[model samples]
Every structure is written in structure tokens, then in C-alpha cells.
Target: MRKIIASLFISLDGVVEAPDQWHFPYFNDEMGAAVDATLGRTDTLLLGRKTYDGFAGAWPEREAAGGEDAGFAKKLGDARKVVVSGQDLSFTWRNSERLEGGLVDGVAALKREPGGDIAMSGSVSVVRELLAHGLLDELHLMVHPIALCKGMRLFEEGEATMPLRLLSSTTFRTGVLHLVYALAESAGDATYDDAKVHLPQDEA
Candidate 1:
């Protein structure tokens, strides 16, 4: 089964909101390389409605001369997009689908499909839901040097204890630390037999 992975670009304090205070300040060679590398590995994408709109509006207009990242944005625009939202809105992007069945169910279905790894980008709400449901297999977080006192978070409020193992970490020239983590197996409840649990692989 393919793993469900989430790639989030966060601040040092875990803020995942609009990093670029203005429209064009966040683009740099390091960021471009990072974005390019991440996009090349994955073909499927999951996004929140707001983020979907954000990319839909910006990437299509970005010219190739903007930078390597703009070229990457064009590549992202060509990939298949699945947007999870309950609000009724029109999507004009090619090869895009609206996930109206709710985040948890939609993701579960996506996990069952036979395809390349699914990457979640800039969708904290969807990411939080997947984390809460124990549906995520890996998390790739790029923690930037800056910290925003107030912004959206990468995780949600909940009581479920999530154990993670750091698979790898790397620091870029721009001071962004890329941390990769896998959800650790449950240490409690020795009686939990995974085979007899009767959960679908996708649901698991």
C-alpha cells in the first residue's frame, strides 16, 4: 500500500499560513529548488479550498521567466488536483476534482487507489483531520526560520497522543529545516491485533 504523506512548509513556531507577507517576497533559489524537488517526486495532490483557489489564481499567471519555482508552479498546475471543500464553488483548472464527501472520507478513498504517493500541500485543516484519524503515514515538514506570532497551525487540537519517529532532517541554505517523520506504531494496548482489527488498509 502506498503511504499517505503530507508536505507542509511551516514557520519555526508551526505557522503554515501565507508565508509571503506580500505576493512576491518568498521566492528564492533555495525555495525554488526545494519546491521543484518536492513536486518531482509526487503526481497526486490534495488541497484545501482556500489553498486550491490560491494556487489556481497565481500559478496559471506566473511566467516562466519568474524563476525555477514559477516553472515548478506550472508543473504543479498540470498535475491532477483534488480539492476538499463543502462550500459550493466552481473550479476551472484542468484535471481537478472537488472532494465534497468531507476530508476524512475523501482521503481514505484516495489512499485505496493504486497510484503514486499522495502529497498534501498547504492544507492544514485536511492535514489535521488525517493526523487525528491516524491516516497519515509520513509527514515532511519544512520549518522556516521566521515565526509568525499569529497564523494558521500545522496541527489541530485533540487528545489523541501521536507518536512520531524522525526519519530524516536537512537544513537548506535559506535556514529552512526539512524534517521527515513517520507515525510510530502504538506503544500502548498490546492486545490490539492489527490483522483481526478488520480495518481496511485504506482506512488504517
Candidate 2:
């Protein structure tokens, strides 16, 4: 099955919305490389309507302008983009389509199809739904050092708890932490005593 991976830029306070306002300052060569690595493995782009609209509106123009970002814009324009939206939408962007049927069922079907990894970005609702249904395979969070205090968050109150295991972590020079995580197979039954093994002991 093709893995569904989500890459999100989040603040220390867990805000995932409006990254454009606070995310760029920490973007550096290392962060660019990490994003490129994710895109390298992705063949399809799964996104929510808002995110889809934002990219569709900007990337094509960027590609047409033919500048430093043009290459990346072209890459996005060429990818198969699947947008999750219930409202009727005309996807004018190249290779773009609206997801058919229910979100969960549609995405589940997509995963079973033969393809490279499906990559998602800036779709908090879609990401949350996938995580709730145990559909998201990997989650890559670029945790910035700032606190937005007010914005949409990746995880909100009254939601069921989900367990995740850290796959890898890297800190960029700009203080952004690139943390990769996968859904844990099981929430381990370790207790405080089990964790005590790692504590430093005083010499007798």
C-alpha cells in the first residue's frame, strides 16, 4: 500500500495554521533539503480545499514567472493533486482532481492503489481525519521555536488520544526541529517504575 505522509510546519504551541506569517524566518538550506527529501518520495499530493486553493493559485503563477522558485512550482504543477472537498469545485490546475465519495473511503482506496508515496501538506483537517482512521503512515513536523498563541492547531481538545513513535529527529541551525513520527503499533504498558531505569543513580 502506498504510504500517506504528511509534512506540516507547526509552532511550539501546536499551531499549524497560517505558517506564512511565522514560518519563513526559520527556513534554511537544511529545511529545504528535508522538504525536498519528502517530495522526492512523493508522487501524489493529497490536500484539503484551502491548501489546494492556495497552492493552485500561487504555484502556476510562480511557474510562469520563471524564477528561483519556478522549478519547485513546476514540480508541483506536474504532480497528481487530489483535493478533498465536498463542495463542487472545478480544478483548473494541471493534473488536479477532487476526491470522490467519502473522505475516509476515498483516501483508503487511494492507499490501496499501486503508486509511490502520497504526500500531504498544510491540510490539518485531512491530516486529523487520516490520523483518526489510522490511515496516515508517517507525520513529519517542522517544529519552529515560536508560539503563535492563537491559530488552528494540528491536534485539538476533546479528540481521542493517539500514540506516535518518533522515527527520527533533526535540529536545524535556525532552531526548527524536524521530527518524523509514525503511529505506534501499541501504546506500551510501561509504568513509572519501568521508566526509572534511565534515571541516574547515586554511588553507595
Candidate 3:
């Protein structure tokens, strides 16, 4: 089975929202190049209901404009999209499908598919559900330097713990730290703190 990967730009305090307010400079050459590089790696995008709505409203038009993010946005517009939603949702974008069941079951079905990997952007709730079930394979965290005092976080309360092994780490001159981790089978011998990774306090 292909790995399920989640990549997000997060803050020091674990906030994953509005990175542009902190580290993201708008549409610079480096940002464009990074967007292009990430798009080349995957063709499947998974999202929550809210992220689906947000992206659906933006990417299609951005693709049409033929602007800076246009090429990558067009690829995303054409990529297979799976949205985990409790409510009924119809998307204008082609190749988009809604997961009309509970998030866990929906993701399990997705994981059974034959593909390279399923990629997630702003699907924190869905990520949490997958992590709790130990269904995710990889996490690509782009840790930005600034700490937002308040924002939506990648982790919330009342979630089970799962252990991860650090696969790689890289630091960019822009002050973004990239940490890639893979899910590991729990040995059940080590102390919980030593074995499991916890989210930052603002994430709670």
C-alpha cells in the first residue's frame, strides 16, 4: 500500500493556520518553486469538509487565471480529490469525490486504493482521526519559526497517542524547519513520553 502523507506549514506553538501572516511571503520565486516541487510528487488530495469548501472556491479560479500559482493550482484542480464530509457537498471541480461516511471509515477505504500516496493540506481533524486509528503512514511537517499566540492547531484534545520515528529533518534559510516522520509500531516498553510525540500546548 502507498503511504498516506500529510504536509502542513505549522508554527512553533503548533498553529497550522495562516502561515502567510508569519513566514509565508506572497508568491515569491522560492515559494513558487516549492509549490511546483510538492505538486510533482502526488496526484491525490484528501481534505475535510471545510478545507474542501475553501479550496474549491479558490483553486478553480486560480487555475483559470494562468497566474503565479496557476500551474500547480491546475494540477490540484485536476487531481483526484477526496473530501471527508458529514454533510452533502457538490464540488464544481472535476475529479472530486465526497466521502459521505464517517471520517475514519472513509479514510480506510481510501487507503485500500492503488495509488502513489494520498496527500493532505489543511485537514487537521481528519489527520487526528487517522492518527488515532494508526492509519497514517507519514507526516511532513514544515515547522515555521514564528509562534502565533492563537490559531487553529494541528492537534486538539481527547486524542490517543501514537509513536513516530524521525525519518529526516532539514532547515531552510527562510527559517522553515522540515521534519519528516514515519509511524512506528509501539514497543510498549518505553515510557510514554519517550515513545510518543505530543503536540505543543497551543495545539491542545
Candidate 4:
């Protein structure tokens, strides 16, 4: 099964909304490379309606003078896109699809298909639902060195406790931290034979 990987840009205070307001200052060569690496791993882009609108509006008309930005825009334009929305609006991007059915069921079915790993970015709401449904496979966060202190946080209050295991951590030259994590094995979901729980017959 293909994995659903989510990459989020969050502040020190956990604010993920409106990254444009505070994300550019922390971006550097290392961070750009990290983004490239992520794009190389996936051909499908999963986005919420808001994020999709933002990206679709910008990436198509963006022009760069021979840099990673140009390349990234091109890659984003070429990648297959699926938006989480109730409206079946006409998508201007190529190879775009809509998830009008229930969100969890639609995304789960997409994961079951044989394809490149699905990647999501800037879709906080969709990512939240994915986590709540236990459908997200991997999470990569670029933690910037600032605090919005009032925007939408990635881990909002009243959400279930999600346990994750740290896979790797890398700090960029610009003080941006790239951290990757996967779901940890929950105690209840952990497989252990009850018969093997007995103490061994050894000298004590």
C-alpha cells in the first residue's frame, strides 16, 4: 500500500496556518533541498480546498529566474492532485481530481491503490482528519524558529493523543528544524502472546 506522507510548516507555537506570513525568512538552501527530496518521493499531491486554492492560484502563473522555486513550481504543476472538498468545482490544474465522497473513505481507497506515495502540504485541516482517522503514514515537519501565538495550530486542543516515534531530525543552516516521525506502536495494538507473559523458570 502507498503511504500518505504529510509535510507541514509550523511555527514554534504550533501555528500552521498562513505560513506565508512567517515562513520565508527561515527558508534556505538546506530547506529547499529538503523540499525537493520530499517531492522526489511522491507524484500525488493531496490538499484541502483552501490549500488547493492557494497553490492552484499561484503555482501556475509563477515565474522564477532559474532556481529551485521554478523547479518546484513545475513539479507541483505536473504532479497529480486530489482536493478534499464538497464542491465539484472545475480545477484548472492538470491531472486534478476531487474527493467529494467522505474524506476518510476516499483517501483510504486512494492509499490502497498502487501508486507513488501521496504527499500533503499546507493542508492543516485535511491533515488533522487524516491523523484522526489513523490514515497518515508518515509526518515531516519543518519547525521554524518563530511563534505566531495565535494562528491555527497543527495539534489543536481537544484532539486525541497521537503517539509517534521519531525517525530522524535535521537542523538547517537557517534555524529551521526538519523532523520526521511515524506512528508509534500503541500498547493495545501491539502484538504479544498472553501465553508468553509468564516468567521463565530460572534461578531467582
Candidate whose TM-score is highest: 2
Question: Candidate 4 local accuracy as lDDT?
Answer: 0.85
For model 4, how big is the CA root-mean-square deviation? 5.8
How does each model score on TM-score?
0.78, 0.94, 0.82, 0.86
What value does the lDDT take at residue 97 in candidate 4? 86
Off by over 4 Å in 3: 26-40, 186-204
User: Which residue pairs does candidate 1 place in steric collision?
Assistant: none
lDDT tens digits, residue span 1-204, model 2: 899989999999999989999999999999988887776447799999999999988999999999998888888888899999999889889999999878999999999999899999889999999999999999999999999999889999999889999999999999999999998867768999999989999989
**CA RMSD per model (angstroms):** 9.8, 1.5, 7.2, 5.8
Report the error of model 2 at residue 82, Å: 0.4
The per-model lDDT (C-alpha) reads 0.75, 0.92, 0.77, 0.85
Clashing pairs in 2: none
**Candidate 4 segments exceeding 4 Å error:** 63-68, 187-204
- Tens digits of per-residue lDDT, candidate 4, 17-87, equal 88888899888889878887876457998998989999888877773445546767888888889999988
Model 3 earns a TM-score of: 0.82
lDDT score for residue 40 of model 4: 44
For model 3, what is the C-alpha lDDT against the true structure? 0.77
Ranking by lDDT: 2, 4, 3, 1
Q: Per-residue error at 183 for model 3, in Å? A: 2.1
